[model samples]
Target: MTPSIAGACGTRLIAQVLIAATVFSGTAARAQESVQTFPVAPSYPAAMPASPLGASVSALLDHARTTNPAFAAQRAETAAARERIESAGALPDPNFQVELMDFTNTMRGGGTTLLPGQVGETRYRIIQPLPGWGKRELQSRAAGAKADQAAAGLDAAWLDLATEIKNAWLRYYTADREAALARESLALLGGLEEAMLARYRQGLAPQQAVLRAQRELTSQRLAQVGIEQRRRGAAAALNGLLARAPDAPLATPADPAALPAALELPALVARARARNPALTADERGIEAARLERERTWADRYPDFSMGLTNNRPRGESQSWDLMFEVMIPLQQSARRAREREAEHMLAAADARRDATGSRLAGEIGAAYANFTSGQETQRLIRSTLLPQARATRDATRAAFETGRADFDAVLEAERQLVDTRMALLQAEVESRMALFELEKLVGDAL
Candidate 1:
């Protein structure tokens, strides 16, 4: 009886252990399934941040100055030229030299040696070169003028880039606007087609009306393809300017820019003469050339150098000597050649300045004329032509629905409305682009 009790208790303990093992194994499997072994992928922002620059003109210009390689190159060029201002006036590096005199005498008794400390006499010298009176100042002034010229060149590059950015922005915005218009027109046509179908069912419209409606729908869809292409192309051009990939996505444009106010031709021309980057660059070039000529002429004078020499002689005390030297302007032919070069460069610089000014005036005049005329046309269309077309379209559609007007009349009115809208869009874009060009030439917005 005791042996039976022992066997039964052992069996119960073994069964309990097996049940616990099963529960633990099941939990381990679930825990393994819950855990992840692979690394999570990183996420990146879109190519064009939403509201980056907020489409502000200043923000855009600043961003371009920071990112565009060509613009950055211009900035670097300006900086390098400006650096010459400091270096041009600096005194020439002082000369230093050492001489070991009769060192072999010390080696006469001892094994041959060439040590400075064992020499019989040693000499050390330092010389400092100084330019003639007014020479260094002239050189510094010349460098300053050159730096100004480089700065003007950088401004010119910026103006050109700004115009391109503005034009591209306008193109992108116009494409979107045109697409919206097309979509609206498509929806309106869809409603009109439905109305036409109902009329046909009631025996109020002809069968061809339904076919014409379908055909118009197809044509509208085809037009959207071109609009989409325009948007993509504009986006690509903009991305290139922003130093991004051609296919990078861009956020939608914000509010449109307001129309700029008008200015008189004389005023614009005067402003262009004063602030235009090309003209300023040319003027600075003339100044630089003139200063360079003066600086070169100053080079015809002699330069002076002061030197200190230390001397020691065998069986003698050390002595210090001060010496002065003058550089003679002996290369007469070379000086004459350089002078002639400077004169020619000055002449060329003056001529370029004149030509640049004349060209600037003409460009400003032409842009002003175009911008003014375009502005007037845009205003007229917006105030009069567009409203008239819209009214005509609404009236014709209503009349056709009541059987008072023909289907041809309704189609003609819709076509006229579309054409008028397109004309308005084209006018606005062209005028704004003209304004941008004008501003570029003037070097500031009017």
Candidate 2:
């Protein structure tokens, strides 16, 4: 071979080696990450060290992890699945038999006289059944995979519980903010009522203006009551999630959890694919189905049972007997049906796994989109809409005092300002809720 050609070949071989090394290392790292100690449970922070809202949420989640009945049920199921692995590969229980021969008076044993306790033979046998070769191992592997699936299910259950708690907390947060805003609006209306009354007494405003302000103040107070009622209901729901009495008091959440500084859609999708518990569970289900299918194929082979017997004849020498039993597996139709059933189940599991992946991807996308939109809306309302509304309210009030605008215009501007502020608050809460949902989907805190 030419030197140049040999050099090029050598370089190509080096590149191939490097590529293989990189792939191998990546695979090894991923495998390590996937290997977890058995009976894995969700981890919670030992202490709440963040904001008050975050701390409260963390504490509630910890409480629910141990106290919630639903979580307990899923945990029990996972434990059961784990235990099944031990029995999956076990041999059938050994059988013991005791037989007395010639016990009736009509028969006599060979070379023995027909006398009481001297003519009968008694046998003791023990038999053990062994499964076909490789069957037990396959059964064990299938059970292990099922246990993994159940563990994933338990993880998913925790995620669901966390999501519900977050959603409930957000709801309560929103309601509480709404009630506060309503009370603030009521106070503002009372001040406006006083100002209008003074203007009417000084002959600068009409009696109708004072009456309109009073009417609005009354309505605002009523709205405050309604908002408070909703807030209480939300609080009760949140308490229920925490496994507390409905009337239990909760510490006011001073602030909502902050959104991530940056969220990349592609990165989020990749994380979800890697960490989503639902998808992981489905993947394990596929593995279990495949293993079960292989086990069914292995079941086509015959199993064996062996028996050892010891017999003693009265006034005669002891004898030993050995026996072997084989299963015929003659029901070809039934075996074939089982194989077909396993094949279909594996196919179904694969389809379900694929469907779960697609659904998770869509959910991640939707949550990210909602989160981004909410952030943008909140920014717009805060930077432009709210300031503009406040400015309009102030300008209208000035115009009314200068006899250039009606009191109605001031009241309308105030209402617009109040509505804009509430919208901004709602947007903020919605954005935070979206983040919580995204975290749940990704199976990690963002």
Candidate 3:
């Protein structure tokens, strides 16, 4: 064979070997990453067995509902609203009165009677005010609608609390993962530094490689410090949700469970329509306004009062009298004003309901999009980018050991791997958070 042809064949064979090695390294790195678990303290508790972070979330929510003053206040308001219904339907209390009339004192020859039995005509009366026809019923309906609105408000408060807790928890999880990854990368860089120093001592690698590795290790350590700070802040925020002291310790699940399957958007929107608490509250407001308008119309009629009287005159038989009274609704202008106010209020409630529904739909759409995109990105990173970065890192390290590549190339590859891993973690956390938000918007679990 010609010399030039042999040289070309040799070069091609080396290239093939490198390519094969690269592929093998990638496969190995992917296997390693799949089995890798973040560092956990021996005393740390195991994650709850059921749903992903379900136990922790439930405990937090229970604490907020039971101990949080805001939640308690909302519940109290709901109870008060419910009590008003009975008051709205009840009749006015009966009034009682007593009168003395036609009493006379007679004196003859400077003599006065000690007692004059039944000398005065005494009268006793009781009166009861009755609401106009259908007025009390209308009032009761309005009150009931208000109670429903209050109940919906309570539900909304609960949902908000739960969402807040979930968000804080997710943030903590992300920060924790970031810290763990930084620590792992630092440890890896430390090992590399030791290897580089050994190689330097043997005069095989330059002193600069050791210094570069040390610098990278220091950077990773600094990053870990920042991550720890973030993790602490996130934990404190979560503690606040649980109504605990800011520095209270919290245990998060070690494994961020897999992403949930995508839900149908139409189904979610429909469910939200039926179950969203804010929308329900707006609907109740509309009903209450309508009922109030009806009540105002009923108020245009006159109310009535009935009375019973007992009377006794001096030397006369006891007598009973019946009396009826009516209230004239003479203030037509005021009644019309009230009716107009109620009509406007009803229209305002309807407009608010429409706005709320639109806002909710938009929120659902955004959350769903975020979740879906995060899921896809996470999958891509885990299945492709992460493995590729790891493979490049391994290949670069091997090439550097063989004097075929520079230390800078190895460092860059390692950095890429770290970044890919962090991105995957972030995407996973974001996906989970988006799911929580979506569930909250839908008013039910997926």
- lDDT string for model 3 (1-446, tens) is 23233344444443454455456445544543563332211111234335432225554565566777788889999999999999999998999987656444332122333334444567889999999999989889899999999999888888887788777777776787677667667756765666666555555566777788888888888888999999899888887777788997777645544456567888889999999999999999999999988888888889999999998665678899999999998999988999899899999999999999999999999998998899889779878997688778877867865668876787798789878887877777677777888778887766
Task: Give the Cα lDDT of each candidate.
Answer: 0.74, 0.75, 0.75
| Off by more than 4 A, model 2 | 1-46, 49-55, 109-119
lDDT of 1 by residue, 245-317 (tens): 8898766666554566566899888889998988999999999999999988998999999999998765678
The candidate, 2 or 3, that scores higher on lDDT is 2
Per-residue lDDT of model 2, residues 1-446, tens digit only: 23233344444443343344334433432332232111111234346445443235676676777778888989999999999998998998999987777766246535544444454877889999989999999999999999999999999888988888877876776777677667666666766676666555555566788888899988888888888888888888877877778888777755433556569999988998999899999999999999999999988899999999999876688899999999999999999999999999999999998998888889889999898998889778867996688678767765665558787897898789778877877777777777877888888877
Q: Output the TM-score of candidate 3.
A: 0.83
Q: CA lDDT of 265 in candidate 1?
A: 91
Candidate 3 local lDDT, residue 404: 89
Ranking by TM-score: 2, 3, 1
What lDDT score goes with residue 199 in model 1?
59
Give the clashing pairs for model 1: none
